[model samples]
Target: MGSLIPCLDLNLIPDYSIAVTPKSEPKLEPLDEELYFSTPNPISNSDPNPDPNSDVIQEFSPVSDITGEESDVFSQYYRISQLFQSVFARKLPQHSDLTVVDPNSLAIVPQPEETGVSAAVLNYKKHSRSAEMIRVSTLAVEDARYFRNLVRTTRMLYDSLRIFSSLEDESGRTIGKRMRGDLRAASLMKSRGLWLNRDKRIIGSIPGIYVGDVFFFRMELCVIGLHGQPQAGIDYVSASQSSNGEPIATSIVVSGGYEDDEDAGDEIIYTGQGGQDRQLARQCVHQKLEGGNLALERSKYYGIEIRVIRGFKYERSITSKIYVYDGLYRIVDCWFDVGKSGFGVYKYRLVRMADQPEMGSAVLKFAGNLRTKPLAARPSGYLSLDISKGRETLPVLLFNDIDSDQEPLLFEYLPKPVFPPYAFQQLGNNFGCDCVSGCSSGCFCAQRNGGEFPYDRNGILLMGKPLILECGSFCCCPPTCQNRVTQKGVKHRLEVFRSRETGWGVRSLDLIPAGSFICEYTGVVLAREQVALFTMNGDSLVYPSRFPKKWVEWGDLSQVFSEFMRPAYPSIPPLNFAVDVSTMRNVACYFSHSSSPNVMVQYVLYDHLNILYPHLMLFAMENIPPLRELSLDYGVADDWGGKLAICN
Candidate 1:
């Protein structure tokens, strides 16, 4: 979920501290290079009498610093870092036999049958200087992933210990609650909840979250439910088990709340910051389901994403925005709560996955951090489209017809689309950028496409130079390299809507700023002759008998106008192929035509270099309000096609 998830309100200060497990904040010792490397605490081992040389590093010197590029035994250093982290954890895996598989070498290293704790520690400490090495190492992103996981795990593992220790010593409930309050007087960054509290935009009644929405409401790590309320279902805490002996995710209810108080006698009337009564409604939901949204017969939501506000042992801190994006879950069951309050309330119990990466505040200090940022996205929505009667769950779309139920004909007759170039080509022995400063100066591809990096920092398309282009697979750069902007997909909140005038149209569920990637109109690639033949035959099949044959004539004329754009964008491949979303489609096919459209199609040549046709991508040309229809110019669609009566 990208820009779509509504930001929390700002004005209303939420008291999330229901019962803070009291634990005193640890004092941060001054940074001392020598002290950090020396054994602050002896390594714990099963040996009742430890070896005198256990703490000694005979082979390596005490590590003073860890700059990723400087170390020769970087691999060995990384492995030991992981080992130290495991030892730091409360629960350790019992290793009687370990199978270290090296697939590339087709080799397997097996541990001895009598393997025990002493051997494990001995094996781990083989890299005599790893502890100090890790402490000093910058911990590049490649090596930082495990370290981040370790920090989060340790915090949670020791939380209970702190609580117990605090109870034994302090005799108070709110004992050491100031762990995050650093006391350095560092500015407490405004939280997402604070921002949302200030937002007064009330859609029907509630500000951002609603039922049927997927991954919309981001729950805080320790928070199990609405700030302090107990009416709805609480976010299940996976750390603990439930009545069913599973992770506890149950009792989340969002009820109408319907159109008006007259209908929703069960409406819970709440006061806003301005002291006006507000009602959270089910207005956004339709009893009549859409063909794409995958909702159950009774339940609305697909599932939700869980985020925990991870607290660290101290050092740097991560903002609430950088959440561990636990993947989406499925709604197991939902039923009418039938509360006495007369609200048409419903409670949905979600089934959390037994295994998934925990998104916590534990991020690498040096390697940036692991966070769930708004996806520079390609898919229109966060969750997958549901399987409906006319559509299969396997993504299907056909652009020519609105109810395009056919699979791409090309797939049946031809091989599936391959990566760019398809076959190897010799390096032209020409100048190519290091991708560091390459985009700024002399990369021929970048100069022709305007700046090397097409998108700005927030993944926004750089203005003035609007023709979207990116370095293809042939480019000697990693995928994460900056020059690939359009490759990153639309991060906006969008939905396909059915209208009276237009069968289906695309719109942003969230407000979209100009220069955002609205969507990419993708489909089967066809040759010019193939598309000509397709329309010639498709005209009769698609146009209903009830409509006059003049529609067919108009379709032909529209084809001509659409082709006039061909010569202008040589990159758009010859009118050789047009994207067909009718059979397998996304939100792009639903976009309607407008003379002054909010979005426009731009040609991009990346991903597939062999295909002469540049991918005609969609981007927002102007600001689009929430729930406003998005349209394309449709290439002078005075007649048909652009303003097709049946847009898939």
Candidate 2:
């Protein structure tokens, strides 16, 4: 095979400007062995399934007339063509394994498996294809416009269909190099387990994963050491965990927790005896510890596991085990360093993906953690629920999924939600133990609170972090179980107040402590497509460049301009759903925007998993004084980096 690519259609090259001669042979150099691809072309009849990649074209089929000077340009097109043809098309490596493949005979290309950090590698050999592609797009291409068109169109169309974009041309205007990089950086494809979008500003941390001190993570090196954790020392080792019993590191499989790590505190490290670690300050690392560079570096790949060393379950079978592979977490950062215990340690944080399956054993083992005591769980709502109902002066946060659009309370008519219909949803499963003993080990309902109620006597979240599992109707216990804190509706007094900057905002009527469980944002749950229909101005919501057309046509003003004069910010995704409070809502609908926000929305996953939407549970990030405006950082910033006006 001489040519590594099929003869692409002449008309199909959307960005092609001039003609190409069939005589233009590939001037591609033997850069390295890391490239391979396939495209269908003519094959012999004897072998029906010939590898399209097996044969290569020696001479090019002329797409259009080309100049003699353009021979070098074709080589670049050939390089990128390889990457464009390839897909993941393979299973993820198992148990931290890496593999090498042969590019030519399709045999393994030999390379040393044992490579060390800080060893300068032949990067040109490793990144040759990317370098060639970048060169062609940057230096070789005579027309910047042409490069922009082909690259952006290909990226957008390929992403939208979740397949190769065979189409040469798409409808909208093509983005330039700068815009493409920005959009790509901001973009996050959870299904792909990758984040490369560079220009997008991240305003918050992934919940439970980056809590407390280890707040700085962005796909780079990080450090984590389990030396002096509170439970044991740094790594949650139990006193019984020793060489004679279980290794201290192994004890983390059972006794380690997220809170313990946060409370363990920082272990500062310096370059010399003095503060010579300029690299630390330059990176603005918020945590003061370091050391675990290898674990952090290797974890950047998709499907790689940031094993928390907690007990989840052994793979392939469902049985209890100490070492929990806390799903496949991305390694945002890691490093090497010293500990606060006056010893060397590594400190880094692994952010849990927003949603994923737990280990099979972990799920089953959780069923045994509930206590026999009566759960204090009860219906969640305000004490004045009866008084607030149907009142025009203030909003009543009804949690029911009723479809009624009640009268306007502050700005316009908002639909009031009754509390989440958990009681009714629970009727389907008998996982709830008999209400008499509350939730017990025998009751699968106890898994909601790790086999115990999640709250103290005063109903505060026991550790300020919980995978809340409120007792459903299936529970044998009464509704007042302490495990039912989130279900026990709005305890904080809040009211809607008109704002000069934002349309309306919510303010606390009483003081609220840090980490307080605030009210959930309730409304008619609708898919992204459904939200687009009513939202006139679709400019406020943050979305990838590829999704702008789906939210609203930029060229179409009437479709985007709302009657209120502000651009509508409808959160859009391929299928992201929104909780529409336009018709009926609680005081949460009036929450304003804050760069340094006091509260943020967290999806509570317990019994029912609504794939279209997670229950948007709001939690206070810090203490709030009485009469202070309650707000959240919605993460939709404008070009100038200011929070959008519609966030309130």
Which candidate ranks first by TM-score, i.e. highest?
Answer: 1
For 284-354, candidate 2 gives per-residue lDDT tens digits of: 12232111122133233222333233322222211122222233334455455544434443444455555
User: How many clashes show up per model?
Assistant: 44, 80
TM-score of each: 0.32, 0.31
lDDT of 1 by residue, 1-648 (tens): 112233222122334443322211111111211211222222322122222112221111111222233132322212222222222121122222333243222222335563334332222232211100000223444334343333222222222122222222222211112111111001010111111211221111121221211111122211211211111112222211111112222122222222221211112221000111123322222111111011121122313332212112322212211212222334455554333334333333444445543222111221121111222322233232321222321232222223443322322211122223432354453434455434532455555443234454455443322234576565666666556766655555444544556666665544454556666665565554555787875641121111111111110111112221111212332333454544554556567775445565656666544335555566665434444567775554342214554353
Error of 1 at 300 (Å): 46
Estimate every model's Cα lDDT from 0 to 1: 0.32, 0.31
Residue 540 miss distance in model 2 (angstroms): 8.1
The per-prediction CA RMSD against the true structure, in angstroms, equals 24.0, 24.0
